[model samples]
Target: MALYNAAALIPSGLLSVVFSLASIFNALNARVFFGEKIAVRVVLAGLLGVSGLILLLWDSLTVSFDPDTVRGIGWALLGTMIFSWGNIASRRNSATRTAPIIANAWGMGIGAGVLLVLALATRQPLVVPTDPTYLAALLYLAVFASVIGFTTYLMLVSQIGSAQAGYATVVFPVVALVISTFFEGYAWTATAVIGIALTLLGDAVMFGRFGRKRAGKILKLT
Candidate 1:
């Protein structure tokens, strides 16, 4: 709902930038909910990430104070906050021995049901997508984005913390841009190159120590 409204009222790139708030929201949620310490590296990495994302999509960014735009920002920020809370929930689930696979399966199933109900209630006609590209994208998002992505992210949250695992959301755009470069001939600007670099540096800083700590835990468990 939030993303749909945002897409209607704002550019996709702008919507994505709004969504990037998930990183900071996750860190704050962790600190509040789980009493996790907010590290300086996490803060620095978030700064770099927001800056890099803005630069990378600077061409797509926009500013407006229209009512619809305001509403879109509100909706997008709501989505980000919900997503951040979900990360903490996933962490809690993992801590409680709920396997990621199980959690993701139930989540998707329930979410699908809810969407169907909403569609019916709202009198939205069900339409099958006939476009091949649309079908392919649907398949990719359902399988890779939802199932595999959510499962792996849940595992990461378990290993590290919800805060660090949330960087996945922050770094996702660079992956899309990389694919665009290869397949869609995305043009690179100086800002883009620097932006990608900063985003990566942020992820490395955010994950470096926690990654090693997770490895050590794995060794000990083994």
Candidate 2:
């Protein structure tokens, strides 16, 4: 997923920096917070993942950044930290807490409230589309991505385990690329194609079939 829109999301120099740091933090947290042992193979997997990300980001090196880009990067980092902490907390606390459904309900409520406050404080309009096409898009987002996706993912985590459930995110980039190709006529440079291929292939090696096998090894006992 990071490979798909990463061209637009990050400036090239910052891609490896952000990814490496975030992943290091997450890996460290897995050891410290979750008491999960990091194996040699896992470390190799991480290296491969980073290599793939670098390949994916090779094109964005020439782009320059503005204030908006800086601000977006800051927000992205903040969100990454929050999400990392949340994942650790969820794994540690899930056994004693309510199911993911209840947790998500509370999370969504809090998230909406936070967004509302931020909008008000920033004096920004909570823009709603007047067009029927946008209205339909909103409805689809609300019903599918916001609701069904959330609930179903939680259920999948409970049943299949979080590792397998998390892999679904890897597919979104392909979806986004397809959409971009059709709507925006996204031209694929050779480098860009290689990046996508590396991203997908590395992601598969890290989290697709091999990931499922690894997860199964642990989950079988559960």
Candidate 3:
């Protein structure tokens, strides 16, 4: 979480790319820890997802040799690694019959406590927003983003393992763009359209929806 906060300070599309790479780490870690075989289709799907992410953020992919930006990128990469470990941990906990809600509760509670201690040690001001708009945004994030999102994701981790569940990060940008078109009046370019298509294709490949017989054959090979 600290790494993620630090990465948010970087001003480049590099973080997006780094975050996409988390899926790779998630997949590799799952293989290492769970003894899961890495199918060729999974590799292809991950590559496609990464390619789509890069294409989606192509316009913002500027090179900055500044020290801070480079440091932030490093922080983002580290955060991605930690995030992947969290995913694997979640999977492990779920396999042990731990309830998702209980796990999330303890995780978030510990994280909040740590942040509070850090804030106090650093003498940081804790300001509560009184603005109605800000309050509403906070409510939405607390309910939908934090509660519902984590629950659903942890459930997915339990059902499908961490590697496939990690694809959610890859798919979120496409969903965000679709929502932005309605809410933020975001205009879609041809490049974005191509990226969206590729992202969907990647998802399809990952899920092995090309054909049941072929998917079975591929699974057997793995």
Candidate 4:
């Protein structure tokens, strides 16, 4: 939340870079701190993901930072660190006794409880519905984003390995931009178009096409 609020002041490009770098650094920490060996494919995927993010936000990369952006950067870094730790822990938990469904339900329930408690304590409005649009937004977030996306992603992690499954998130901005263009009437700049191309290319690199014999060979090497 803090990081997102900070993002309002910071350039989106810088925020993306900061988050990407944090995740990469956390992956490195997985190797050093947790003693999980880093695969070459994972490293290459990280590079491609960050590069794509850079290309995606190339036009906004020049914005000067303010105090809020600085704070936002700190939050972004910390949030990612926490997130990485959670990922590692969740993976470990899955490897142990618990099923992924139970783990996810517990985690989400606890998180929601914490947020609700905080909101109530601070007198924040839990539901300030001015229109039916708010209900539709809630339904979309609950049904599509939270329920479906998380469920599928966790399943993907178990099947493909977390590092590979993680690459799916790198395409979120591409989806967002496409939606914005169609629904919000966003103008497409040449840079934006190029960014989308790069993002898709990066995804292809991260998730090598099934028919690519060379990529299959590389996976075998890994």
Candidate 5:
């Protein structure tokens, strides 16, 4: 819904930043609902990750007070918060011993059903794409992007808690750029390099890989 509403109204960079805020939301939600301690590293790493995103997107970034832009930002952020909450819900379900694969399957199925109902309500025609290229892209997204991505992410949440797993959301943009550089011929810039460094540093801090002892001191699990 966020992308549907805002993709044309705002820069892709802005949308990515908004969506990447799942880390902070997940940490807060976990702290409230599960009594998980709010590790300082979680917040600090999130800040670093957001800074990296800004730099990475600096060339194409935009700022405006226009109503359309503001509305788009709002929608994107609202959707991201909802997604963050969903992540915590999945974690809770995992805690109750539900398998991540099964949980993910049900979630996707139910979401698709809801979308189908909404399309019918809006009188939108549901037409299957026949183009081979489109079909191939859809298959890649369904298998590699959705099924594998969500299953592994939910497993991470179950293992390390949602606060930590949430940073995976922040790190994904950098991963995408890396993949694009190989397959899509993306060019790198000095600014983007520094941004990637910061993002990696943030991940290290979040995962206790920065300086094993120091990160352990800073990132306490509660």
Candidate 6:
């Protein structure tokens, strides 16, 4: 999470696009670390989702690059790798009977301690925000994103294998885009439409929403 926040300092939309690769890393880690057998459909869905992400951000990524942009992308990739490891850890902990809420509380506490130490060592100011908006945002992040969101995701990791659960990262961008359209005045382009369609299709495929008969036919062909 620290790595992810660090990467957000980068000014390039490409950083956001690259970060979506965490889903791929998560799937791979589930196989390597947990010995989870990845289904063909899952791989296909991941590929489609990644392709959609590329299309979704292709325009933003075409901007002229700088050394800082390159470095930022590297940080984003590194963060994504670490995030995948976190997913694996969550899955492992859940397997060992650690409740999601308990695991998240401990994990968040330890992470906060590490960040506090880092801030102190760096001599960063630890002043609290006075702005009501800032405080509200922080509260929302703490409650919705950190608590509810993570708990649900960890629960999903326990119910489904990590590979399938990792698709959440891929789906997040689509939601962000919708929010951007309304709140940030983002324009919907042809490429974005196609990307959204592909992303939805990938999600459907991942969840076996294509129907059992269709899945069986595809399986037989493969």
Cα lDDT tens digits for candidate 4, 1-222 = 645665876777676666665435545766866687665555666676777777777777876577766777787777666656656666676678566777778878998899899899999987677788988998998888877767666666666655666565566666777798899997877777776776666566656653244455777876
Clash totals, every prediction: 0, 0, 0, 0, 0, 0
lDDT of each: 0.83, 0.57, 0.79, 0.68, 0.84, 0.79
**RMSD vs true structure, all candidates:** 5.7, 6.2, 2.5, 3.9, 2.7, 2.6
Point out where model 3 deviates above 4 Å.
211-222
- Model 1: per-residue lDDT, tens digit, 1-222? 667878898888888788876778888999999898666667677877878888998998867779988888888998888888888889889889999999888888888999999999999999998999999999999989889988988888889787777777777888899999999999999998998888887877677876445445655675
Between candidates 2 and 6, name the one with more favorable lDDT: 6
TM-score of 2: 0.66
The top-ranked prediction according to TM-score is: 5
Candidate 3 lDDT over 119-201, as tens digits, reads 99999999997999999999998889988888889899899878788888788777777898999998888887787778888
Candidate achieving the largest lDDT: 5
Which model is ahead, 1 or 3, in terms of lDDT? 1
Among all windows of 10 consecutive residues in model 2, the one with the lowest summed lDDT is 161-170
Alpha-carbon runs more than 4 Å astray in model 2: 1-25, 39-43, 57-61, 65-71, 121-128, 156-171, 182-184, 207-222
Better of 4 and 6 by lDDT: 6
Model 4: C-alpha RMSD to truth?
3.9
**What's model 4's lDDT at 36?**
72
Q: In terms of TM-score, which candidate is stronger, 2 or 4?
A: 4
For candidate 1, the per-residue lDDT at 49 reads 82
Q: Which tens-of-lDDT digit does each residue in 161-195 have in candidate 2?
A: 33333434434444566688899997777766776
Clashing pairs in 2: none
Give Cα distance to truth, residue 104, candidate 4, Å. Answer: 1.9
What's model 3's overall lDDT?
Answer: 0.79
List the candidate 5 regions with Cα displacement exceeding 4 Å.
209-222
Sequence-dependent TM-score of model 4: 0.77
